[model samples]
Target: MRILLSILLVLLFVPDWSGEPRLPLLPDAAAFRVEQVVLDRRDPARTKLGGLTYLGGVELHGPGPAFGGFSAMMVEGERFTLLSDGGNIVSFVMGGDWTPRAVRFAALPAGPGRGWHKRERDSESLTRDPATGQLWVGFERANEIWRYAPGFAAAQAHSAPPAMVKWSSNGGAEAMVRLRDGRFVVLAEDRRGSVKGTVRGLAFNSDPVKAPRHGFTFSYRPSRGFKPTDMAELPDGRIAILNRRFAVSSAFTAALTLVPRAAIRPGAVVTGREIARFESPVRHDNFEALAVVREGRDTILWIASDDNQWPAQRSLLLKFRLDI
Candidate 1:
């Protein structure tokens, strides 16, 4: 009887390693390491943006186990918000020096699934309505999008649009953006239909859940061997997309491309012009987050990497300027 009682106590007190751990509502920030890096080591003194400039970046570390895996981001001046693939939120304010301050961290208030596994909460893309302060997050495995109130207080609505039904479980809705004209666009990560390098793009008339059927399809041609990760809208109304590629020998590379607004219509096969590329000799990682902010006369671009919560890779955030 005593042995059974001891076993019961152990089972009750000890956490089960088989399931996903419950994350805290707000996690404390630890010491984060920031480093000034150059995009091309050969030209470390280059200060120009547009193409690629080596702005300062950071290697974020935290007390909690869920720190990296950032897949999407939104930037408003010095204020930034990041959404991790593991369904965590990391927001902070930074200055021109690229040092983060007033950092805050939290997990998504609600997820699509029962939260039993990480895939069930694989949030890969994010977008925001600046006018209303509403935010939208796209979950991959479930192929659904959830709209949240400002500050992520609550999930207002959710939808699994029919256009995303055929997308691969791990590659669904990898990039999403709300255009200034009030249209929402969602791009699949790995749904190559009839054409190679061609992914499906869905454009919604309004909020997805409210009008799920009011959407049309288009084709997006990413760079060869690369897949679209995130997207942002330029002040000029063009769309900027971040594409990524990974290989066994080359590791990872990324590119930024610009799609003209005129080409984003229904049934159109759209391919953007590559503006910048990050490859060997350039300090690049798994850069998955992209956000654009318009300053006085300059358009600032921000890109962040996902460390995959691995020891080898570092979470890097880079800033640039779009000279267009």
Candidate 2:
């Protein structure tokens, strides 16, 4: 029976989702690995940082199917939580030696759709509230934001704000940050509202989902032809934004800009001052994720790149100390 054989094959290869539980699945102990790499091949110990100092970096690799595509990240001391574009979550602890330990991998307990296709789960941005430990994720295709409980145990709420409904399918919310003053800022990856080089931004007073209708509009200007990828707030209330550009020959390049707090007023267009640029002689890729941590008098910056799950590209994680 040809029909019977086809049915059997489908049952053997497809995972059962009818009774799937709400908890995340644990990955194998040896699923993830990391190898150190120098930012500059010539020196191997020094890197070009316009206003920062390079600490170290590594190339991440794994044998699992959903290992790469990390577009956003959250860091708490030595613990790191990364979210992939495929809607998978990878969390691990890295010691001073750059070795990853206690690695755990899982899928989002809930997403915008049924997780049937890659577009249905194209999560692009992430932000966390330090006071509450709550996490917020931005999905690109659906153009919505979902809030997860601490530890990502469950999805508590989600929203598809009217302002973000018109964003491009693949260019929806790409960067987000919860400011220290309890305000939330979200930046679109593409230009909107008749603006050529400017992207749309939204600021919320409280939780985005709860106060979805209570927000104001603003504009963000990235480098020409570049798009905002990620943002992190500094200890002194300024914000740093990462913008990326891709070309056929040059592959990829990135820029870091700093925005003053006073320039973030509602209904205003804000442009950040370029602080650093990544180009040739400096190892760079699709650097999309950013996070900042303060250690006494030093400001530590962490950046991660998305390999796009391609063989030719490598996942990169870099650290630098901002010199103010």
Top lDDT model: 2
The lDDT of each candidate is 0.84, 0.85
Worst 10 residues of 2 by lDDT: 17-26
Estimate, for each residue in 102-184, the C-alpha lDDT of model 1 and write its tens digit. 88877888878755467778999999999999999999989999999999999999988988887899899999999999999
Against the hidden reference, what TM-scores do the models get? 0.91, 0.92
Candidate 2: segments with Cα more than 4 A from true spot: 4-27
Q: Provide the lDDT at 184 for model 2.
A: 87
For candidate 1, which ten residues in a row score worst on lDDT? 17-26
| lDDT score for residue 157 of model 1 | 94
Tens-place lDDT digits, model 2, residues 16-109: 4333342223356546778998878877878657987888988999775568888999999999998988888888898679999888888888
Highest-TM-score candidate: 2
What is the Å distance of residue 202 in model 1 from its true position? 0.5
